[model samples]
Target: MQNVTIVICNYNYGRFLAKAIDSALEQDYPATQVLVIDDGSTDGSREIIESYGGRVKALYKQNGGQVSAYNDAVNMLETEFVILLDSDDLLYGHAVSNVMRVFESGNFVKVQFRLDVIDPAGKPSGTYVPHSAAPSDCGSPLRQGWLYPSPPASGNAYRTSALKKIFPVPEADINRYGADFYAIYGVALLGAVATIPESLGAYRVHRTENSGIDFANSESNDKAPKALTKRWAILRQMARARLGIELPLSFHDFSLEKAHFCSAVYQAPFTKRWRWVSRQSHSYFRSIVGNPFWSYKKKIGTLALSSLCLLPFSALSDFAVRYIANPLARRRF
Candidate 1:
């Protein structure tokens, strides 16, 4: 059997830590190794990690954020394949086995699967992430500057060799919160990414402030677009340096374009909000038309939805902000 490791990174999530660890330990695959990295949690998270004792290998470090934890884990892991599980999420019993099977079947650098969304109480929210299925081969779309569907960190399993080529990513604040963006995009440049259409894990949604689950949080709304833009630029630079692949400077994803539109609508000065909204709306329209992977039906539907951006700031725009533009809101229902 091939060896696989699940690295669970945690900060102050003591309330939800045990369940995440148990999920890793209970995987049906015998060769699975569970490693938990506690990034200086002050909320009794240390005791919970210590209780695992011999079953898991634990590393305790100061709070250097998520990228730091990933950096530390990659430096020490010798497993052939690796999965990074957030401290608040979970892996199904067969997740490791399924991922290993796919890895054995092809020369893929990454394997991505769907995630069921659950509320804080562990109740099903009747939703799954990515909203759209990922394509088996992403190179064509990627070359066209289109970002194919992908889930958050916990939903991906990567080849350790490919990860080593991409890791030790710059420990900046942007990367600290969005390491998965670098991992997913970076590895895609190295080789193909396999897609498993079924749900293999659970992603918990809650109002943890920094979790970015609450749509009403103005700070999160304001920072999301700017952060996404920065991450894209960083990935472009990393691809050139690490893989010698020069990606296009322009990129488009409908969901992210919508985010920029909503942010401009709410954050721009009152006197200039319309101009910002119009610019973002045009960008959103271009993304819909240019996307090669989307069907005509999907493109038409999204175009109709994008039309709502033209309305002035009122009840209709408010509706667009909540239902049409907010990714979290769209994911929830």
Candidate 2:
């Protein structure tokens, strides 16, 4: 295995933080090192982190959210690959070795693996996300379309070179609010990603766990939409300034896309909803058309809806989407 740095960021998770550190320390990879950042936890986190002595390096700072902690970690890491872990989660013993086995000479910006859901007591929840195996090298982003439903942060491994290309991410709302969106999505846009087919980690579901970007968490419900908007805006800005690629998508543009896909936006305030769909319909129409991942039949249906975006038939379109399109498509969020 290559020289890798496992970065575990912690807040008030003192009880579970030790297991997370132990998991990183116990990695069988010969060249692996552990760095733990205690993000200004009021709890006894410092004592526990200090207890590790020289086995793990520790960085202590005020609680500035995950983005701040992540940015700090990246700035300090000189390793080839960085694996992020959460304080409340546990990494399988072979996670690092398995991910490194697939790291060949390629343009893979990152490697992500699935996580098994576990309760507070660490019992299995019997649910696996993405529900599909992608063990082989995925040359491009999973699909050519939009980067929706990004993989979880802790289970992924990213190359340092790839991250430097997208560093100093604009600390907009999403960067401050969502933990992994800025890095994950930015890296995905930069190059291809490889997904390990096996489950390499456990995501602890509990009330006290710092629910960074989880929408199901009670605190994250309201922050999700605003965070998503900020993420889209930053992507557009980066594409223009750094990559010189004029993006076909943006915050408002995605609003139109989501409306078409979910149909539930019709229930939103009329002027706000109408303004977005009307302005972005043309862009949305073209964006979804040439995407091979989208079926010709679905394209035809969306195109038809786009044609009527400016009209007063949004209520009907919304009805079709909320009642018919989503049910028929069976897309999981």
Candidate 3:
């Protein structure tokens, strides 16, 4: 049996951290270790973790953010794989067993499971979204991007070796908004990824959740949209330098892929805030020209959208992003 190290970072999620840790410790999988990094939390979170006693290897550190905690915890892993579980979430009963099978098979480089959004009290809100694949049948790489279908990196599992090869984690900035997206993108560019069909966990959502708030202002709603705009730029560059290609015209058309689709994240109300629209258009054009498949029609449309994107409301394709486009991406794998 291979060893698995589960790293959970908690800031002030005192209400939920205990349950999350308890669930991890109770995994049916064998040869597992749990590491809980409390990032200078003052909200009695430390006390609750301490209650876990020797069950988990608990580390105390200043508030360097989640990535910092991840960086620190990963260094202590002698295990074969690392599972980054959020402090506010709960793993499904068989999540450990399922992940262990994939790691032990030695064929799968990474695996992401379906996720359900739960409320603060840990109850389902009647919004049960199935993952793209079931454990028995892993989905396509492109479909993996639609797993979370949201901004980035909330519900996914990775091989420690592959993760280390791409990123050591605890990255320098600690301020990265879509850090998980960057990590997942790096993994996709470098290694093969598999999708587990079963819903592996509940991604808790609430006003006070670490992810639901803006890290900088800590109170603004713009944090997510701002992070996404930056991610779009990064992906464009990665596609050019690494893949030697650009995002497809199909990628943009999919943005408005009628009645419903994922790329619509670009449509947040704040998405049309001018700053993001300008930058996204800049990246989109660069991608269109760089993509070999971009036809004359696409070139013309890209130019048209670019011009229209600059205007408010009338040219507001961003609206398509928020309402129609983003739903498919909430858990983008």
User: What are the root-mean-square deviations of the candidates from the true structure over C-alphas?
Assistant: 3.3, 6.8, 8.4
| TM value for model 3 | 0.65
The TM-score that candidate 1 achieves is 0.88
Better of 2 and 3 by lDDT: 2
lDDT score for residue 121 of model 2: 81
**lDDT per residue as tens, model 1, 100-206:** 99999999999999988887888876668766766777866776678888888899999999999988888886567677777887787778899888999999877
* Tens-digit lDDT string for candidate 2 (213-276): 1213223434445666666667667766876655555433233344343432344455655666
User: Which has the greatest TM-score?
Assistant: 1
Q: How many backbone clashes does candidate 1 have?
A: 0
How many clashes in each candidate? 0, 0, 22
TM-score of each: 0.88, 0.71, 0.65
List residue ranges in candidate 2 displaced over 4 A: 132-145, 172-174, 207-219, 251-333
Q: lDDT tens digits, residues 176-242, model 3?
A: 3345655565555545666665567777655532222111112234444444445545555655565
As for TM-score, the candidate ahead, 1 or 3, is 1
Q: How does candidate 2 score on lDDT?
A: 0.66
Cα shift from native, residue 90, model 1 (Å): 1.0
Put the candidates in lDDT order, highest first.
1, 2, 3
